[model samples]
Target: MESPLKNFAEVARKFCAWAETQPVSTENEVKTAIELLANLSSAILATSNLGFGEDLEGERISDEEWRVTYNRFGFLPFNYYSTFFNPANVGKEEPVIGDLADDLADIYRDLKAGFWLYDRGHVKEAVWEWRQSFQTHWGRHATGALYALHAWSTNESIQL
Candidate 1:
């Protein structure tokens, strides 16, 4: 059987491949991509929640041990969001680590709007708006956006 970490990595790779093919100009395609991204994000969070193996005593290990375990399992490398998103790093300074986190937040905002629209029975409009927002906000670092999109899609399917 595959481990949760391995499953999460596989799903992430699938999402990235799908995102690359998503149509930036089409409303429906973008909406679908966003939904897929949301689902992918949820899966990653779930996997992370599983935590690394614990000792028989069930004590939490140090950060270094956790990192080593995660890395050894072929998980995606970690990055600090604070280092990437801090504005001070943009001009004369270097960018912080949380840049991807910032982008993910933007994607989440758009996804929330889309979710509200769908909840309000305005699926068509919601889809259109999400596509527009995605076009405006999506960048080379599309991981977060994709995760949000996947979550949205999966949730909708479950509801139906």
Candidate 2:
């Protein structure tokens, strides 16, 4: 059987490829995004805790590049949603605005970093990159984006 890390890499690749297509906010695109995000989220969890590997430097994706990715999803029906910085502090704290585009872009950027290492025959490093980033970063974006996308999908009143 293939390793869980490999499985996650596959899912990440699929989601990244779809994002690279610069999907619009058409009904089909929305559906696809929802499904892919869900799949990616689940796949990420399956990797659980991975062992650390050699630390390798990778090229950083510039903010301008990220902005281009964000702009691609301009056709989305909604971009902003209200969420708490910490859900546990819900009643005590004010909700902050979360941007779906930002969530997607961050997820893409994090996964791509792991993909860079994995593609270069550094499986352990790639797994470490993914697991670490997931725990510290992309995991939050994935959940927030999933929640937002779920809201968008279930509401029939919101047109694509």
Candidate 3:
């Protein structure tokens, strides 16, 4: 059987490669978004079993670098959406505005950081980076973006 880490690495690499290309058409972008998000969602689940490693001090992405990727996702149909703190208190609690582009950009940055470590032969550090970021950051963005993308893809009449 293939190692879980290896499996995750493959998915993460594929997602980064696709994001790098910056798909042009609206239809292609939507389809790719759904596919990538679904695959990433599944791949991330495997990281729970990965052991923690010492931080390798991977490079941080600057705001300028982030905006480059964020802007590349400009073609996403749905940019903004409403998010609730608790589903049961949806009406009582104020909904926060979520951006699909922000989610994609953030996820990309997080994964890219791990990539930097992984490519440099720091496999354990790479796994640690992925798992830690998944818990603290990108995981939330991924779920939110996946939910929005799924909704948009399923319903043709859903307006932006």
- In order, candidate lDDTs are 0.43, 0.79, 0.82
Candidate 3 has an lDDT of 0.82
| Residue 61 Cα positional deviation in candidate 3, in Å, after optimal superposition | 2.4
lDDT of 3 by residue, 95-125 (tens): 8899989999999899999988989988888
What is the lDDT, from 0 to 100, of the residue 26 in candidate 1? 32
Stretches of model 3 off by over 4 angstroms after superposition: 88-91, 157-160
Top lDDT model: 3
**TM-scores of the models, in the given order?**
0.32, 0.89, 0.89
Put down candidate 1 lDDT per residue, 56-124, tens digits, no spaces. 121233456434433332211222333333344557676544343334334444445545554565545
- Candidates sorted on TM-score, descending: 2, 3, 1
Deviation (Å) of 130 in candidate 3: 0.5
**TM-score of candidate 3 to 2 decimals:** 0.89
The better-scoring model by lDDT among 1 and 3 is 3
Write down the worst ten-residue block by lDDT for model 2: 50-59
What residue runs in model 2 are displaced by over 4 Å at the alpha carbon?
157-160
